[model samples]
Target: MDSILFIEIESSYKAIPLLVFKRDHHSSIIKKSHVRIYSDAHALLMAIEEQVQEFQKLIEQQTIQMIEDKERELNEHISHLQASAIHQLTLSQQQWFEKAEEQLNKLLDAQEKRLSEAIADARNSMASAIRNRLIKMNQSDSLIGYLSDALHAELNDVEKSLVIVKSYSDNGTTLTIENDDCMVSINTQELLSELKSCLENISDD
Candidate 1:
């Protein structure tokens, strides 16, 4: 039988040992035991470091995913806002154009009405002026004929002896009678005036 030594590690609050090891009487194996303990401790530390690195990679990946999601959300929001603004602008422009067109139509209608009225007034004025001119022309022709008949009646016997001359001026019409002895002048306007007064008196009677 080989001589063996037993060692136990325990906490102060527990009666059972947390760890147990068996040692043999080979003095040279004790050094190998120390080496084994160091190797196991180093392996555990390596595993723990690897686990920490994996955890760090996981945290970095989660952060990157969160950042990407936030950027996507922000981009979508901006796009929505731009679309809404464009729609609103289009509606506003349409309304403005419609209003402007309506106003322009109204202005055109009013201008057309005014032009028509002005044209009617001008035509009426021209017609009245032409009618008055025709009446005046008729009256002047009648007056000239009456004057010629009176002159002929008065100088019936001396028609060949008398040289009669007629002149027109802005003030009135004039008649000149010339003979070997003297010349006579008569204003046709005064004769016409006296004739008009005689006609008026006869009408009143």
Candidate 2:
């Protein structure tokens, strides 16, 4: 069934005018259509959320790169220092080498601690910032607008014969149809769908 319909086929008639309103077809087409619409909406939202997760992954990759760079630089510095100390020292290997090694170890330990703390602090701050940004995006008015925009695009041109208008207002978010015979009013929030009083005409008499 089309998301919007302007006419219905009656027996062998062509282009029979139809006024489909809500509260009709409760057990059938309307229910399925509502479910389909919501499912599509959820899929789109998840896709957008995946982008956020990808951004977090990028942050993690950059952090790891920074740690690797720092470690490489520190290793090069330590290697240079150890070589210089071993070559320039005047004392015997047993005494002077021992002292040089001890001092170098002390310097390496201090430098490693500093680097670890800096990386830890940076990672925490970056992760916190990402979470905060995502929270803001989820909670802000932007989310509503995004939902409206995405819904509009996702459910585009549902029916060529019917004119559909998506509106967002203080009252509610709705999809309205301009049809001479049938009026489709979809409360995008509640998203209830049905043909109004369609069962009233059913008669056994």
Candidate 3:
């Protein structure tokens, strides 16, 4: 693969859309057809981290090899030019040296630019992958059914006249419940009925 990648998927029952990783385009095949599967936040992140380490090591090795090869090539070229200049007219040989020097300089500049661009592109892709991984990791995995049931039960104890409700998330539950009815227009009977209906629906499920 040209790049290392991972995938994650999430589905919700409350008409919520399936959540898929924003990145990851690697392909696989099964049964003569392509198949794409999902991974959790933890596994996806670990894969990315491992890929990053591998890329760094590859880059380092390539850089060392390029440097050594370029040095040896330059030295050989310089020696050849010096030998030719010694048998030629002085002024003619000076022009050859200048031309060769400029050529080498241009070659070095081009190589440096190419390397810089590749590294920058790699960094941008890695950042994007890491960002997506973190978002998935932070997302809560509690089922929507569980959350709805729990919230409905808690709302039952709240008075009908109350306009605002708060639940702490420190214990992994934080929600805001709002009662639109004013105190003067409080319908305790209707609120109790609604709560009962919700409970019954949960039991049926």
Best by lDDT: 1
Error of 3 at 126 (Å): 0.6
lDDT of 1 by residue, 1-205 (tens): 9987643423431342223224455542333465457557668989999999999999999999999999999999999999999999999999999999999999999999999878766765655565455436433866666666666556562444565677887646787765555655667657655655554454344
Name the regions of candidate 2 deviating beyond 4 angstroms.
1-91, 144-205
lDDT of 1: 0.66
Model 3 compared with the native: what TM-score?
Answer: 0.27
Ranking by lDDT: 1, 2, 3
List per-prediction Cα lDDT, in the order shown.
Answer: 0.66, 0.58, 0.52
lDDT of 1 at 114: 99
Q: Which window of 10 residues has the lowest lDDT sum in candidate 1?
A: 12-21
lDDT of 2 at 99: 93
Question: Model 1, residue 117: what's the lDDT?
Answer: 76
TM-score of each: 0.43, 0.28, 0.27
- The prediction achieving the highest TM-score against the true structure is 1
Better of 1 and 3 by TM-score: 1
Tens-place lDDT per residue, model 2, 140-168, is: 45545555454445445344544456676
**lDDT of model 1 at residue 34?**
50
Off by over 4 Å in 1: 1-44, 130-205
